[model samples]
Target: MRLRNYLLTSIILLTSLPVLAQYGSQKKADNLFNKFSFVSAAQVYHNLIEKDFNADYATRQLADSYAFMRNPDSAVVYYKKVVEQPNVPIAYYYNYAQALRGVKAYKESRVWLKRYKKAGGEINDEKFLKDSDFINSIFNAKQQYFLTDVNFNSKYSDFGAYEHDGHIYFASSRNTGVSTKHIYGWNEEPFLDIYVTDKSVNDSIIDHKSKLKGDINTIYHEGPITITKDGKTIFFSRNNFSKNVLGKDEEGMTNLKIYKASLIEDEWTNIEELPFNSNDFSNGHPALNNDGTKLYFASNMPDGFGGTDIYYVDINNDGSFGKPQNLGNVVNTDKNERFPFINNEGVLFFSSDGHPGLGLLDIFGTVSDKDNNIISVLNLGVPVNSSKDDFSFFMNEDGLSGYFASNRNGGIGSDDIYAYDRIPQLKIEGTITDITTNTPVPNAMVTLLDSNNKEIARLETDDDGNYEINIDRDTDYIINIKKDNYIEDTRQVSSKGLENKVRSITADFNLNRIVKKVTPITELYPIYFDFNKFDIRRDGTVELDRIVNLMMNTYPSMIIKIESHTDSRGSSKYNDKLSLDRANATYKYLVDKGVDPNRITEYKGYGEQKLTNDCDDTMDCTEEQHQANRRTQFIVIKME
Candidate 1:
């Protein structure tokens, strides 16, 4: 978990694995990697593997280097080679999963993440593993938003689109751009610059795009702009390479800085760097407060909480800037916290690789208290944020619809800008308990079915017998509850007929025991065994599962006696054996399905002694009537 010591560990690994002179290249790579210069380190490690020296270990490190370097495409390539290998480091599973996500391989990512959670020891974060399942659940949960790629997106990487009034401004690395043709080492993509395009009309997007005019679109990376409501002042992120005054960090790489400029005479003028801009660390992704009194941005500056922290600064009345304050650990983790976007309601939306998520960086939202401290953070869930690099979330003035960036699968570009709008929301919940005892039935299956009787959501009850699921606003739903040994229960709970508002209601399921007070309820569902076979049929198992639930959970104190009956068509001795075999097979099935074996007091064949209808050999009865005579029934004999 402590990555600062990785350099020492890598150095020791290199020296012990091979002769110093033979693996000097690896040592150099280790040193570079220790300094967090992952791009160059990945190259060295890659070359070492190509030369057939330490290929196994280099494969893992190389993948990690690419991952730390923010080059998911390359990381995915190398990580796949070492992810399933034995004796590999545990962290590789997590990194491999994230790399897969960065490439929008969510299912594959989930497989590796499962491995990561299994391998978790000292690096265990239980919530992280739990949230992984939640990520999958979010797919079937209430979906209130839709996404589509805009037409102006480039084949390279086009994202971070924000709209002001009518026109939309964004960042792009289109090859057609002017000035610098430099390609960034990370991801091997062209440098980014600010670009402007008209907002899509009626969901119709166009390819009309051009670089933002003036010195703002410099040789270095730029864009992710936010404008004041007045449209007079604008803040944008750019590398400190403009005007030949490049500011590099300790790694000799240029750091990003926030710049402010004014719109005057039909052009951006008074371009000045923000006072908080530093050469030692990167700062970018500026978001202005609704009233322009505060500025929120991401930075890796000194004394910061993480790789990047969302910080806000005050704008004094005299136009002076206030001290930058960290948004704190609740929102900023040791991993990354980037792309801070504050909505009209003062809720902060940011992208984070630090929080519990599907994979890679996920969009998260948090609201601040009066002191600017984070109160709570929620993963934007799914669709709004996929299992990839979903960041740069922006909300239009409408607050219900907006745009964001995602490198998820099916994107036309490495990263594409997508427009989205909120769907509707409905919350449904209930409790599952026993009808006889009125006791909570923990871990009971609570399934939500649509009007068509198709299962839409399946959840389990907690210790308190509580379960919840989200649905669309105003929809009819059937809630089904099932637990071992208990009779299945189904209840109808409708969000329909409700007005435009959130609704929460409890729909408790009281399950009765299949064997109730010395009576065998053959009225529930009939179970019949085929001739010469004792195996439980599909329909039999369905009926038996409830019996198993009733005996094991709902009425553990009741002793059950299962009697198997047969039609008169079979011989007396043969019928007796056949019926007994049927009873025993059913008995084994209940036990195998988690019912207590001791709960079954007696199980025997009645042969033709107990017929439900006139299906004897001498009688003219239909096959259906004969089948009804051959049935399995359970009776409650005694209570413990």
Candidate 2:
């Protein structure tokens, strides 16, 4: 009986060799594919197909290869074929469902998703629900969650991404650092360079095809670029090689420096070193404010939480900088927190590895004031993060879709940039008014236009003189409020900079009255200006141009008064003189811009006499409200 058992075991071992070999080859291919080596894995899987025509493992892996290559159609073909086989693992259906979702087969994705769950499949549930990739389809499918895999680069390790003016700037360690001079092993290259790319609306991404007409490329480690809204200024992280004679005995490396450059007439010059940067500590990841007047960044300097702390600096009027202020214990912890991003509305977003999250490093957003006080902080959670390190997130103008860099699983290479469209949460609202009565007009027609100024939605005002419209995030929209007897009022909302927040716009409409030459001072919105300034800033330009255009068209035969005011910052007599000069300057500029001088009336300045604030600079009053006391405005006094 013992001899018979031994014979049976030997026969079993001999028979299992072929099966074991086949499993080993498939496992190897899967491993290679997971590491982003699709070419080698595809070749191996191809060989397996030739050896065993009945093997389905190789077929699944081959589909994954096509998916890694971004050929979703071929991936779908193989994935669909795998589902037809009996007794396959539930992961096949789950993964195939994700692939189907990637190719935008919402109905089919729901079918496989339901099948996987029914077959007891479980993995990455949060990804299915939260990832912006399937947001549209998942909502359409009425499904809660789905499975997702990242697509990375096979040859290069991308670390950072910044979007501006229809182009993308990023840091990469691919096909570079061949020489020993710039050598850093494992994490990244010694000289991580910044590369620019033009991403089209289509799925095609082109590198170095942007119209960046300057020496943006540096020999040293020049990376992590943050461009301003106008694309005129750039703040980048760089490592400068300076001989450290006293700090080190011998063989010391260079110091890391953050540099600022301005684009002058399509060229980058006037490169200046930021004073807030310290030599002993590494200061990088500079995030610029919407107006480019402040910078939020990460530094390892003293008086931090422990590792790296987020800091801020104010750019002064004379182009100088103030002392760096550390963002306190709320937003930053005693960890290697870095990669700061500040939105236009002073919302701060960053990545932190030590924070409680679903991934190694999760992206977090916080609301902050000008004093660097963190009001609220929230982790982006599952969809925006993963088990691996996730960082370098940027939202586009519409806040819906943008590029983020990550080293997550199932990527094309080491680290690849992924463009994700955020699920939109938008609310459109307005009030309708009578053309002549100056009261609410019920049931007025309203049309919402998209970024290209195309009509997207329509609504009507309620009896309460209010209307609300819902929309997706990341959409450039225009609100066109029209009543039968009134002029069509069109307004625009720039959703490009608003990624994950609600935008409120008041679309107030006023119909043309039956009375001739309608001119109402109370009806016009109040215009505010800074102290001792005649030139309108960008924000002020929007409102000022509206008044200018109104006067030029509606009140063409009228004479207007340009009035200026000042706070009690100086002596009343001196303030009055300065205000008069500013008012005259504004008047001349308008005349030069083609506004008829005969239609222009008197220009007057009321310095300290017409002060808006009760307290002067010498009195016990805050400087903030005092700054608001100064102003420039116009009054249509007489009709020609």
Candidate 3:
């Protein structure tokens, strides 16, 4: 009895050990995750899953952790399991959908997106669901930027490139001269610091880099800055560290804040934190308008639409700031929106994962009115974006060249700076020709119209029937060709895929010539006859109707004669009778179709005498040649 009791007690304790361990592990993982230590939390959750202890919860947490770390490829593996379980959270459906997109699984991502919507989850962008072709349009849009990595990138996180005073200012985690470095837990890299490098005349290269001269360099994170036009002041993002104390919110987390410094003589001094910053949330990635009248940055203070939202404040002439205002729902989504850049033309460029993109975060541009209301957002397609996080976009006043950063593959660092130049031009060129003789239809009026049928330009073809016109990229165009004695031709052409590398597109036009005077009906379609047959074929009647309509409607006073010929396969006497019967058959067809009998001036048969080729019974020829000889013609006799 004692031995049995001992074994039962041992079994109970052993069975309870795993549950206790799982409970403790779950608490630890949750704490790390809430602290924004996603990398550490993911490892703990992954271990719990491998042991099959609280497997469902562990899987969900693991998926969330990877998602927060922007490791979608790994997150998708765990999310696939979490979403399949019963009673899954509605938010997980959205997370899975976004994860699927990060791996370029767009079709599957849309499926979950619809499920998320059906589950009462609100999607801010209704157009994303209503426009079924939206995703396809993003993928099919023309490539506007050509990107190349800068030569000065390091093996650490190097990004946030900006230009001012002949120097390129940026943020990097490549800490130098620090005896001991404090590493950020999120990416396991050194904390970010502000750095500057001399800009080479050739934009592709850069001179040696050094830390910005100032007391601005702190032990905490700093950088991704914006400077005033006169170079008298600067605004940069840093951790909530001031004086000698590091500030933390009630949650024991350090948040980002914007700080301003003045350039005095040769050193930057008088550092002061922006007034609207909070210890409870993050506000960073600063940008300024062309005249330095507005300051824009991303923040998640409170009541934001997503993890982070873009906000801007007015800069008074006395160096004071107004209240921060959200950029509105049109530009903000249920995901992180960061790195706001305003060009000289008032176009805003930023990065977002919420919008439909190839994968991860994609850079998008929007034009705003004077009141700062966005009209529409456009994805900066192709080499400018990739299946990874892309942010910190900067455009020069010229708007033709710029710089951006991405953590995509084949880079020298966790993130790398890239230079981009817009494609110069796109053109459409083509030739116009007549259908009858395949001759050039020169001097033809060629009109170009936009997709809405609005005329854009009109010109005439050159002496060679060729015309060339410049066109905008990624647009649909209609080419209308018209010439005297030729039927009008319209063609729909798209310049979508041609923007990648091809500079020009060829769109030739062919116009059919209308019958005006004496001409053989065979010029349009040969009125063919079967061997030894006199009845009009179904095809032959179609050609006969054209003659009937021309005489009755188009040219009421026109007259024509029906003449038929036969091949050399039969005797001359037999061929003559067959040809005559065919001529009479055509004559009767026109009269039955309401053509005046007076219009048919004559009906005759030429028999084998008018053999078109050398197949006069003695010379063997192909069937096509023999068939050509057995044809009928409706020659115009007179026209008034």
Candidate 4:
């Protein structure tokens, strides 16, 4: 039995004789909901609440029905009550959060999102919360596209605009005025069908529109197609209907599939489902690469990272296929990601509710490397997206113009197709070099900040010391450059008044290298003692005072070791004792001059050894040469 029937039977068996009427009403409403007639089910559920009969269950079901109908305003009202009920399902918290976002209650949505996480909801809530500022950055981004609604929109749903061979093909639910027209129960709208029209001469007003010529437009839902460069083959999404029968899964729910059709004699014929279609899960919204060697689509197959993830299959030269590969976590999230469109430049554009956005679904563009690895995902920002479902993006080879769909306010229908022209990107490019050497400073950190000092982009310079970045027109930015052992540099730049004319700006930086000696010794006269004496002499005191000034004031954290030596004229045993006393005497002098005892790491004596010159007993050297051997040396061990 279906969940509705089982639930109804349970309610009937559990209820007493006094509440049969209430249970009877619930059974009727549950039947409508089970049949996918959400509009009718919502009305019945509302009636149950008005009569105060099992209002809690009625309210929860009512909210779900409205959500199925895509009416968040109505859903939020009942969902609020459902969530406040004791022991409500944890999923309801997530549902409530999404509903709040639909109404532009972002702050309230985040609050519920936190509650959902606290309730053990299994989403990457921590990352989502930490990226809240990133969402705000997208909202505050400059407008990139100029959008206007197309004139072909209808009072019902109309979206998914694709242009091929100077004509526009789209999906619509506009009534065909047929007496036997089928109605979709979920939204109470007519079944979607593929429609085509000539490209508007004025780019917005369509002279005429008609159903696509072919068997491709089924009585069931169909549309959102992609055509090859040769224009001979077309791939489109359709209900899982074949051989005059609608296919369903084990749970009695229909799923969508991608179908291929050939253009023969001005008619689309030989329609066939792709080999990957299944009754268990949906695979729809086909997109093609520029060369048509790869086909991309959205699916909800098992082990997917989200409700729906974008997958692509390689179309081999012999007309065979490769296994589908998921686009991975960088693009897919725990929410729906759909409508994959790859532009001529190989950039992927799709709509997602998963990524942080203004609200609902928003269009985003991908930046990939030469190996096709995604490096970054960029939100298209306002005018192309709003706090509503925006998707079905299609861009021309030039990339400066495109079309998209949205259900945002002021649309002529539930979803309307909008044409847009992208503004040319403004950029800043430059190199960083060392000031003294005039050489490139590779791998230097380059940061771009807005007028308010908020970071917009941060990257490292390439091997050539070159850095390039895109910026908004008519905005002020701060460029900061930094590298190790070099002084950081900052420069202010402005794109104001440049508008769409000037495309690039140059900003270079020259950093000064920090110069410091690494050796332990400081430049000073040698500290020499009298013959066989460890006491401080007048000449030795001069050098000792300089060492005290350096250790006590210049570098307080500096640690040094004292090494004392003696001339070869003294006995080895006698010289060792004299050198030891001299080393100790120097250590005591520095300590008495207010230097920390711990700063002197060691005091060592090397007698009649490590002579600077050949002044041993076998050679008769001058008195000055012997004095050099009696000197003390200070070796710095540590310095901060």
TM accuracy, model 1: 0.46
Listed in order, each prediction's TM-score against the native is 0.46, 0.44, 0.48, 0.47
Q: Is candidate 1 or candidate 3 better by TM-score?
A: 3
Candidate 1 lDDT tens digits, 113-145: 788778762334445433433222212233446
**How close to the true structure is residue 525 of candidate 4, measured as C-alpha lDDT?**
52
Q: How many backbone clashes does candidate 4 have?
A: 0
Off by over 4 Å in 1: 1-140, 177-180, 200-209, 368-373, 424-472, 475-640
**lDDT of candidate 4 at residue 22, scale 0 to 100:** 58
Query: Distance from true position, residue 368, model 4, in Å?
Result: 1.7
**lDDT (Cα, tens digit) per residue for candidate 4, span 272-343:** 899888999999999998888999999999899969999999999997778999999989999999999988
Q: Which tens-of-lDDT digit does each residue in 1-640 have in candidate 2?
A: 0000000000000000122355456545644543334556677788877886324556766775665444567778987877886544456676578778777887988798889888776545564444434312222222211223323232566767777876667876554324444555545554467766654544233333332356554555666879877788888887653332222213464555678889988777667778876567778888887788888788888888988888889988897889998888877888978889876545677888766666677777663332545544556654567788888876554434556667787776677767665433334455676533347877677776666665544556777667765443334557777666456677666433442423343446654423235555433343555765656556655665666676688767655678877778778888888778767766776787678776565678888777666777667777687767666677655543
What CA root-mean-square deviation does each model show from the true structure? 21.0, 29.5, 22.8, 25.5
**Which of 1 and 4 is the better model by lDDT?**
4
- Which number leads on lDDT? 4
Q: Give, for candidate 1, the lowest lDDT window spanning 10 residues.
A: 1-10
Clashing residue pairs found in predicted model 1: 144-423, 484-549, 485-548, 485-549, 485-550, 486-549, 486-550
Using alpha carbons, what is the TM-score of model 4? 0.47
